[model samples]
Target: MWFKHLIFYRFTQPFTLTADELEEKLTAKCFKPCGSQDISTYGWVPPLGRHGDMLTHSAGDFIIITARKEEKILPASVIRDALDEKIETIEQEQNRKVASKEKKLLKDDILMTLLPRAFTRHQTISAYIDRQEGWLIVDASSHNKAEELTSCLRDSIGSLPVINPPVKNAPSHFMTQWLSPKAVLPVPFALGDECELREPGDEGGQIKASKQELTAEEITGHLDAGKQVSKLALSWDDALTFVLGDDLVIRKLKFTEVIQDQLDAINAETAAEQFDADFSVMTLTLRKLLTDLINALGGEIDEASRGEYIEKKILEVSKKQQTAEETAQETA
Candidate 1:
């Protein structure tokens, strides 16, 4: 509600006024603008006027005197004087309306409905029901008058009630948990060991072996045999550095190397199945490699020292890979 009423003004031409001159003008009664101070300080019905501008009041006060760059210069004082006179005329009309017997209430007019009542020569106060809060909102140009009126209204109502400031907006209640920032957990993916293999010869002669496990030496042999790498495994420390950083990293190591190495080993194995069996088996092996890698990287991360390390390492490796890829592409 406050944001809606917040006003900002940008002058077409910058104003030139000395600090002393500005202060002097602000102090003058004739230069004072309605609602120049706190708008809500008065009451629900704050005095209305332009938020910020060079203007005049009928008392002949120059509201704002600042330099203008225009060739045909307009004195702010002169414009203010004219506007002030016009405002006086308008005030007279408003007074007449207030006095008119035929005037209709601009707001709720139910008999005995709480409405502003003159508290003193300079002050008027009122109370309104705040249905949302089940309370009453008081308004008055003078805080003293508002307080007095609040007491009188309560007495008239014959019930003990909470007195509150004017309600410009609805009551708000926030759930504490809702206001808390959410922690986004990293997405989970199955590790190489978890990947299931199709039966041997499922893809004709494309694959041969369908085993789920492969030793480190066997993995290296596959790489030597020129098979495409699909998965790889690493020690816990290596996995931690790859996924969570040496300081903060969190991505699992690629299983491509492991798969490739395994393929080579399978080729070298004397028990290697038929060409079709070999291809089929390698495909399943690749899947297992990926599953294992994921599992290794997904281990619980040390939140303190290890957190920052992992983050830094992950970033470094990612940057290096990206750079290498770019270089290769450029060469091509």
Candidate 2:
């Protein structure tokens, strides 16, 4: 119902599916509980809380989707204890020290047996499709996790015209300019009292200064002395506050007290109505702040070479998957 983080992607081409159409497509891969012997499962869930079977949640042109991934949480220590005890018992009975390969096989057997009875943990990530704006906003802090959502989506709908959206201005330069401001500050944005600065390179020189006014001499001195802003905290038009990273990941999100107070006034007679209202308000706030942020950063980049970049990123991810598979095969 409430989203805390975002990883955004732009639709490089037109996306013309309606909510009903989307639901029909996604229903093919709707969430299923993990089997007794299964390690993990990922699929779509109803974004409209406990009431609906449909996966897509719509607020005007925004079509929201939630992904639930459940995985068994078998601890390594538990397995280790069981394995050590078994090894000791075998040694006392009829065995010498177990070979390393034999020990590994025994551990694997134990894990497979324990998995059926192991406790499971589930996490749901909410995402919204801004069809009108040609962007998909996923509630994820990691690029890999966000891309997992994208992969699930592509599997569901057959195709998606998405790529990691690029901002025209480099984040470091943009933040430095905003902090010192030789020119006027970007409209609809204000600096907050938290920042992390780093000297650029592999040497790993950095400073984290927070709760002090960013404009003050103490803070400005770091910038003047030879540090570039790697991550800076910002307040967005009193609706949301977050730390913006140089890679454009938004973290540490807290809705401003002002927006919450306004939201509190919109009481609904029914639970469903309340749920709808909450999502609508949240989605609108994100849309406004992100749209403005994108605009201020010279809007989304539309270069001829962007297609090549997207293909390269996809290839990198593909290579990672291939490498992982090869490693697993070798290990096997």
Candidate 3:
């Protein structure tokens, strides 16, 4: 499936597991329907759903996986009304106010009572592992949801040595540079009519513009007043369009007509075949887009340097912990 957003992580160490090995590990956590009284469940699922039975779908060098989550839908208002009624009844009958701790226990009991009857909602997030690129790209709009899939994968595979890959330049800084008075964006990158600018400081003001020329006097005026671009929409080679954030998260990703034309050319006969074609073409296009985008943003931090940086940070933390322990001992 085409991902509408991307939150990618880079593997610190080499990803050596083959598709079959991964499928075996994932099978241990295959998705199952939530049980009565269960609030939520998370597990692996087939990438192609009913069209394909395999837990992992391999396209070229990339392997695709899906995580399914199911949660009961218990409204806060309903719970509040129920709790109020019960609390009022207990207080009236016992002639005393319910304590905070007692109220918490009552709420827990109420949840258990209502969970089995509550309607359920389901969502699935898909991700692809690029072994050669050492990237785990998730189709999630938020970092929290993306981490849910990675957390499940870590539990399945024992460990996942992945990090939010670092880049040489800050995304916001570089993006702001591109829109500066004398700057020019890299080849094939053209500005779209949307951006968010924020002033510098904790309490700084922010503004958003949509469907307006980014080079307009009003926008550059914000930059002149010491504001930075936090989010900017841009297109790549007429193939893909997306909004890049200061945090390097890609949002509102759209594969353009160029990509669609390629898919249309495939014209696969079966549903499974179409799905396969879409995944293959989309992944390939995305790979190219990532490559160019990274270069334009001054490239990714190489693995060796990233490893060294991580080691230094870990050592610093360890020293701080040791110092804290010594202080505690002295105080004791």
**The best candidate in terms of lDDT:** 3
State the local distance difference test value for candidate 3. 0.89
The candidate, 2 or 3, that scores higher on TM-score is 3
Evaluate model 3: give its TM-score: 0.91
Error of 2 at 78 (Å): 1.7
Tell me how far candidate 1 lies from the true structure as C-alpha RMSD in angstroms: 34.9
lDDT of 1 at 195: 15
The local distance difference test score of each candidate is 0.30, 0.84, 0.89
Give stretches of model 3 more than 4 Å off.
302-304, 312-332
Model 1: per-residue Cα lDDT over 1-332, one tens digit each = 00000011111122333334433443322222123121122212211123323221111111111111111222446445644554556569776323222222311131112212212122333233322223222323334444444434334334333422122221111111111134122233221321111222335222122233432334334433433222221233111212211111122433345444545665443332333233344334323433343333343333364445555655764696699789999754
Candidate 2, residues 1-332, lDDT tens digits: the string is 77777788888787899999999999989888889889999999998768776788788988889999999999899999999988888788985888888888988888899999999999888889988878898888888888779989999999877867667678888888787845465887888888998987879689898897887777678888888999888888877889888888888888878777877899878877777788888888888888888887777667776777778867876898899899999988
Q: lDDT by residue for model 3 over 126-162, one digit each (tens)?
A: 9999888888899998988997898899899999878
TM-score of 1: 0.15
Of candidates 3 and 1, the better by lDDT:
3
lDDT score, residue 208, model 3? 99
Model 3 is weakest, by summed lDDT over 10 consecutive residues, at: 309-318
